[model samples]
Target: MEMVRELASKKAAVIFTKSSCCMCHSIKALFYELGASPTVHELDQDANGREIEWALRSLGCNPAVPAVFIGGQFVGSAKDVISLHLDGSLKQMLINAKAIWF
Candidate 1:
């Protein structure tokens, strides 16, 4: 949990992902399309992968991978992000976090 928190806080936009996860890819693409240069942590490629997955689960990320943190705050998974996008709030959040210039 501490490690996750520390990593999340290091960037304005952070995404915890798994290489083979399609939803993770989609979420990353979404951020890229929005012009936010997010820090991506691939759980499958990390030594503490399993532990971080467990920690993210504790943080309310049920599936763990694709967990997003914006401005050091948990913003949830793909569905949550897509919802935010649909509601036109995701861009505002990114702007507020200074993740995207516009």
Candidate 2:
């Protein structure tokens, strides 16, 4: 409902990750466990991944694997995501994404 509406109103959420990146997989797994499936933009596969890497770097963030964004807001890397979950803030984020939680 509200979360789905908010996600639909946004442009897109991109996740920059590589195949061997453990943090990338962890974030994806966490999202799955939370029931919020995000659109991943794998930097290792997309031809424009380099450009995305550049964009993230320009934002004063290191071009690291598992970078995330929702509604164009930078959400940081996998450790950041885990911290959000551990701190109980991830629920709000999932709510905004219209995710059906367990």
Task: Tell me, by TM-score, which candidate is best.
Answer: 1
Q: Could you estimate the TM-score for every candidate?
A: 0.98, 0.76
Cα displacement (angstroms), candidate 1, residue 25, comes to 0.1
Instruction: Give the winner by lDDT.
Output: 1
Give per-residue CA lDDT, model 1, range 2-90, as digits (tens): 99999999999999999999999999999999999999999999999999999999998988889999999999999999999999999
| Clashes per candidate, residues 3 or more apart or on different chains | 0, 2
Residue 50 of model 1 has an lDDT of 95
Expressed as tens digits, the lDDT of each residue in 1-102 for candidate 2 is 233233324734446677778888888788767767677767788786676666666655564678776555677777777798899987677676555444
lDDT of each: 0.97, 0.67
Over the full model, what C-alpha lDDT does candidate 1 score relative to the true structure?
A: 0.97
- Each prediction's RMSD to truth: 0.5, 5.8
